[model samples]
Target: MRFTLFISAILLLGCTPKDTIAIERQLILSADFSHYDNFFPIQTLNLIKKGIKDKIHIMYVCFDPGIDGEKEFPGEDYMDDFSFKIMKDGKYQPTFDKSALVIGNDFKEYFKEDFDSYKKLKAEGNISRFIEMPEKPEWWQYDQTPKNSKGKPMTFICQIDMGRIIINDDCRLFVFYDQDDRMVKYVYQRT
Candidate 1:
């Protein structure tokens, strides 16, 4: 009975009305990035990748043009770019500009900063104002438009929309997500 309900809920999610903001609100608020981050930051992402096959999933009809392949950061290939989109027949669509997420050890500090900000936001009841990001990864953002640490132009559709992610002194990551939640892009520096 429980399994049946779960499947039904999943299916119902996709069927929500196009003009409805409730579904999206519920989806985003329900997400606990900390839970995933706790076990899968840069230093341990590889282990998590090897051990756990999947952590999250999203459904989109199509993603606009974006970067592709692995953008390596000198010492490792921790930062990965997965940019895609989903098409839903809705009059009021939203975008989730999440291209400023950093993963792994390099992003630990960034996440710490974001977590601190999140705490403040939560305490002030202003969490609705803006999403947080890892701290101090802005240096990477200055490299070039649609580019990474290697100075190579990134063609992918994702880029940091707001905030930066800094793990440790040497590692950094970026995030990009569409407001429509169509493209949930997450770039993390893997140690």
Candidate 2:
């Protein structure tokens, strides 16, 4: 009976599920931002907002290691509940879309200011530009060891985008990664 169940499981694994096969062809910057509580550690997000020359799509992905409930993000309701804030002359101001809790106000302005530049570049056929990662904290790969299904030791790699930026207990910013950067992981949230 156990052997039969095992074989069935194997067959299921072999078949590609419909949900897994569909490709989400949207460009989004995936990051984890639930760990930050206030505004001090959010300098990176604040700075990013000040930079960026065009409108770009960002897909953020946040994983909370301590809490298990659904993550709270900024959107239409409160309008000011995010890991990062937009400040002008040391005061908060509303500018970009706060729906996804994404940082870098400059990124939003870039899109709005140069709508045709991006399209022009696309039309010119020179569209492959790599996004530069700023000097910030990231997840480390060497510290943690990978484990198999049976919990045995295996190889490990880490991709850290950003992490908890805490100016004080009340204010912070959290960032995470979508790809693995094998070396240099500091200020990375340890899972």
For each candidate, what TM-score against the reference?
Answer: 0.26, 0.20
Q: After TM-score superposition, what is the CA distance of residue 17 in candidate 1 from its true location, in Å?
A: 18
What lDDT tens digits, residue by residue, belong to model 1 across residues 1-191? Answer: 74565345334322212212212223332233222332222110111222322122221111112322133222222234334332342122222322223345544565566555434544554222222222223435344223343544432221222232222223233443333343334453322
- lDDT top scorer: 1
Whole-model lDDT values for every prediction: 0.30, 0.25
Give the residue spans of candidate 2 off by over 4 A: 1-112, 130-191
Off by over 4 Å in 1: 1-34, 38-107, 130-191
Clashes of each: 41, 22
Q: Least lDDT summed over 10 consecutive residues: which range in candidate 2?
A: 178-187
